[model samples]
Target: EPEALDPRLRAPDLVDRELSVGLPDAATRRALLERLLADVPRAGDVDLGAVAARTPGFVVADLAAVRREAAVSAALRGAGSDPSEQVRQSDLLDAVGSVRPISLSGGGTLGSGGLTLDDVGDMTEVKAALTEAVLWPLRHPDSFARLGVDAPRGVLLYGPPGGGKTFLLRALAGSGDLNVFAVKGAELLDKYVGESERAVRELFRRAGEAAPALIFLDEVDALAPRRGGSTDAGVADRVVAALLTELDGATPLREVVVVGATNRPELIDPAMLRPGRLERLVFVPPPDAAARADILRAAGRDVPLADDVDLDALASELDGYSAADCAALLREAALTAMRESLDAGEVTAAHLATARRAVRASLDPAQVAELEAYARRRSDG
Candidate 1:
């Protein structure tokens, strides 16, 4: 962004001193909330400490906004006419949900979408592994300290596209009260020298400021490919070097975990996958019949299905359908029912049969085999 400013104003020597103000920690957040709510009429259920703990990335202004939003909600519910009506804890909680923190509104950050791992259909093993590697460290750090071992640094998730890799990230972020900063690997690249490296540093800096965070690097193969073979004026090589440096930087990632997702993990640099980096490599395999059934059920929870429409039978027939494909099938079926009869009350088996022809499977058999082979190689070695 400095590149966008005038040359004279953006000069490196123009500024005398730089001071960085980050989001408030838990104690500060509680104090700020208490001060803000001191004059407001609050119900006994209102707990500032609980609200402070939940607002991890919220700044001073965001906290103020939460108080304001809670008051507005109470007023809308006829608080002005009724003296007993006050801002309840539910109002504050809802206000927190409504207000988006400035720290998370940036391009580098992502919202958790309020989906937990339990919302995910199946992939029992994948969920269990991630729960232990990513969630466990943040939720139960004391266990690691008692065992005299450091928590895991990062995890690498790889599989065929549409196998719910990104979906898993959303679940992971929402599983706990942690911040999530996500960026596509290609988005980190810049033609200007040192800009990519600066982006990496800035990303990590933000993650550190919002401690107990997860930095998700999507499509990481593009960001950190094999070192020596690139025609792009050594920019890719420099980016890889920057990533490696940050992954094992001297400052250390205190409460931050980096999770990289790629469909082609074989293309990533070896150094990035070494110990203490993204060492926990987990393969998100394509959903089996049972998983597909679960996906269908999850996706069609709101869709009115006729008695004849059997998801289990449909999932069994859809052998190669990815998780996304199964969800899409239900969507198309609903549309088919709408088209066939405007007053149709529910999606029928015939509607699903018609929709199946339109929503073909996106999973590539060759890519799945290659990823499976890569997983085998990793396991063997």
Candidate 2:
């Protein structure tokens, strides 16, 4: 509806005056927040103006999400036991951390209708590694304290493209009731000077405020590419430096964990992979035959498959295929069947075979070898 209207329709004769809605300023956001929270019980420390200033471009829905998150936090903190208990300023700040800005990359907050480990196809080793690195520390803090060992600060998931690295991170995020700020690495890079570093700082500050938070950085290579001799005027280097400071600065990250995923881990700076930084490196390989079958079955859950279709056979045929590749195969097969006959009863093995022939696997042998070698080096370390 906001798209450009036809010239004839835009004329005063056909349409009335148009009013453009822009992002609310600080004062307007404060007014909106006050109105939205009128019925909600809030603590004396809760400042609507502060919340509004923090949320510059938030809309009505985002403000509503903040209120809902604050209420949830209050309930979790034993607010139900006391009828007079109110949502505190800290709860509102944490809620802001959970309610992502409208202009930010990625989607909704994790653990809010997010995918769990069960939703991901078989990746037993990968899942176990993630659990050990993230979930175990979060769920069993006392265990680490007893052993006098520091839990890993960050985890780096490196793998082939579409091999479910990001999916695994999402499952980890959903495993517990944690605040997750998901962002693409390249999205952090800003054209303006100092903006990227400031964004990084703000991101970590929010994560710290929302303790038990998970900052999932997808495509980390773009964010922390190997520094020195950079042509982009050191923007990437500055961003990486800022990220390093956030990860292992004088002020420690109490309960927050940074998870970074990338296909090219070698491109990431060495500083990021240090012991106190993104120390734990987990390799996510391409899906095996079993995982491929699982992916195919999951992808075809809604589609009507013919009895002649053998998922195991299709899986076996999809050698070197990633989970995404398997999904594409199923979609292509469905389309092939539809093209053959509009009234086709269901996707048959023949259709699948045609799709297999048409769509080749996307994995490059050289790249796979490189990833394997990288995994070996990490394992050795």
lDDT of 1 by residue, 1-381 (tens): 444657787566896454657679889999999999999998989999999988988999999999999999898896568866799999999998889887777777766677777667887888888778877897788999999998988899999888888988988777557888999988888558889998988899889878878899999999999999998899999999888888895568878889999999999999999988999999999898999999888778789999998889999999889999998898899999889888989999999999999999898999999999999999997
CA shift at 251, candidate 1, in angstroms? 2.6
Q: TM-score for each prediction?
A: 0.92, 0.70
Worst 10 residues of 1 by lDDT: 1-10
lDDT for 128 (candidate 2): 88
Query: What is the lDDT of every predicted structure here?
Result: 0.88, 0.81
Off by over 4 Å in 2: 1-114, 174-176, 340-345
Position 363, candidate 2: lDDT: 88
| Count of backbone clashes, every candidate in sequence | 0, 0
Q: Write the per-residue lDDT of candidate 2 for residues 151-244, one digit (tens) a residue.
A: 8888999889988887777776655446577778878895599989978887876566455567888899999999995799999999989999
> Considering only N, C-alpha and C atoms within 3 Å, which residue pairs clash in candidate 2?
none
- Model 2: lDDT equals 0.81
